[model samples]
Target: MSRKENAASLVQDYAEVFICPVCGDTVEVVELKSVVCPKRHTFDFAKQGYINISTRSMKVNYDKELFAARENIIMKHKLYDPLHTRLLEVIKVEAANNPRSLLLDAGAGEGSHLAKILDQMKTVTGIGIDISKEGIRLAASKSEKAMWLVGDLANIPVKDQSLHTIINILSPANYQEFKRVLIENGLMIKVVPGANYLIELRDTILEEQKRFFTNEETISLFKQHYSDVQIEELTYTKELHQEELRDLIKMSPLSWNAEQESINEVRNREHFGITIDLAILIGKNR
Candidate 1:
């Protein structure tokens, strides 16, 4: 099918999950290309295979170049393969009984992680939502058999009690919105940075010492809102070539504040070993 046709098909397939961003009314597919609510609000599907569900314009710091850099670092370098594997293991168990499970990747920038996970699972549908228009455009163009939307995390455009599994990887969380949208017994998988994450990059550019990250406060907050909370820590060091190193610096926000000279210095290195330290937190709605 063509890209426009695929996008329309996705809208027809998962129309029920969408709600009018302006009025909060349930939306239905109309003519396979637009979604309309009872209140007469309509959203059109873009030719590139995504929908814009935002009611107003909002600007963020991310851009096409950053997302492109992220895609290269993720797909070409396979930097997060281990984390992806672990996520699939947990998702397989959660979705064992229900083959047609629904998964949402909140803050799904560029949609690489969601697409990779969906490629391994059968009879499962995924939704990738992000606030950045550029990120959503890249995701819609590259990831097939999924729905993409430009929406906010604080006020998700999905209906209440609609999602079976929600994945928040290296993104901020809105627990109240998450709990409201999740089905009963739905699983939420969140990944946060650990103390040693990207130590090499930190050491390369920064002059002053910075405190290490700890998840004690975050874990405590999660426990207050969810049941059966579990946490797993993963840490490893990987060697990166010069090009991969350049993409890595471009993909991260840490380099945004650094001087051009500093960025060039890091990019010019022949090779370097960087640490990947992360914590995966899993929880179920209380």
Candidate 2:
């Protein structure tokens, strides 16, 4: 099937999962090209293979260049390979008895993580949602099997109690929305930055800035919402080449406010060992 056909197929296959962001009414697939609610609110699928279900215009800071840089770091350099592997392991265990599981990646920038996870799972259907149009465009290009939508995390366009697993990787969480979308006994896997995460880059950009990071508050928040919450810390150092280093800095928000001169200085470094410290929080609905 053509890319357009594939996208239409995805929309038709998962039509029941979506609801109109405006009216909060169930949306129906229209001619495999658009989705419409009873109130006549319509959303069209992009030719490139994705849909936009955002109720209002978003003014996000992320752009095509940032997502491209992130894609390079994630797909080409395999920067998050270890984390992906661990997530897959957890997914296998969680989905062992339950086939036909539905996984949602909230704030999925470029859809790399969800795309990678979907590749390994046999019976899992994936949906990736992000607020950035640029990120969703990149995500649509990366994976046709998974449905990609541009929508707000706070007001996720999916129906309530619809998802089996929700993955929030290094992204802000809307606990109320998450709970509303999750089914009974649904799993939520959240990845948060640990104290030493990307220490080299942080130190490079702001040497004098006190490097204090913590997930204590985040963990407490998760515990309040979930019944069986577990936190695991994963840390490792990877030697990055000059180009990878450049992409890392360009792709991260840490360099957003830094001067061009400072970025160039970091880019000129031949090699830098960077830490990938993250806390993975696994929780089940209460």
Candidate 3:
């Protein structure tokens, strides 16, 4: 049976072992009990079976046009294939040792990574949450098995210490929230842009755009929240056609900062290969 069916079958199984989104504890999952911990904090799951445990909701800007461009780019090609491959490899590594259970894709913009990763795993149910309504809508339509939520990362609305694995790819991360939501021995996977990720695009946008990206910084931050951090960088070049060129700019943050003249020049140029520097960091919750 599918994971959705499986998750439904175990509705009561979670009644006792719910992962508390606050304090990272294994809290009770009973209904109308007014969830409370020794610390005197309390939360309640909504009628929809989702609990809001996040500390606060963040202000996010998400427009249909921006998400539309992102959808166009992600659907057309393998822009994030290397990152996706690494995530599956890690998930498989974990599954080889035990049964795969719950998977969380935090900041899971539109669910491509979760869909791809779970497509390779067995008996894993996925929850994908992003603050962008547009993103969650895309994710909801991305697959049947993955439950999609329009939510924030700093305050994950989950049971504390309840998740098996969470993958954060090319997006914002809240290590504290992740640490809270992950079970002991749980895995957290994060991907960030390495320097030279879009050098051509960056250079076109400005002469000194290098100040914005730092893979080293990303690693440094992960070290604070997780133990045994591992970093990997994958590089490839894809010769671009006109349509791909358009795809490249539309989804790129660099494009948002580019001058109109440079944007016009990029549109006119014919061929270029981008160096995609991505870092994959995997660690256990401490």
Supply every candidate's count of residue pairs whose N, Cα or C atoms clash at under 3 angstroms.
0, 0, 6
Per-residue lDDT for 1-286 in model 3, tens only? 4433433334335444444455655454333434555565666433333334446665666666666667665566667676677778787776566564778899877667787777767777788888766666666666555655556677665677878888888888888889988988889888888887877678766657343666777788898889877777777767777777777787777776667887888878887667777778888887
Candidate 3 wrong stretches, greater than 4 Å: 1-59, 209-212
User: Where does candidate 2 stray beyond 4 Å?
Assistant: none
**lDDT value for model 2:** 0.88
TM-score of 1: 0.96
The segments of candidate 1 whose C-alpha lies over 4 angstroms from its true place after superposition are none
In TM-score terms, candidate 2 sits at 0.96
Candidate 1 local Cα displacement, residue 258, angstroms: 2.7
RMSD of every prediction: 1.4, 1.4, 4.8
TM-score of each: 0.96, 0.96, 0.79
Clashing pairs in 3: 19-159, 19-160, 20-159, 20-160, 21-159, 21-160
Q: Write the per-residue lDDT of candidate 1 for residues 79-117, one digit (tens) a residue.
A: 999999999999988888787788999999999999889
**Can you list the residue pairs that collide in candidate 1?**
none
* Model 3 weakest 10-residue run by lDDT: 3-12
RMSD of 1: 1.4
Error of 3 at 240 (Å): 2.1
lDDT of 2 by residue, 233-280 (tens): 999999999999989998898887666787788899999999999999
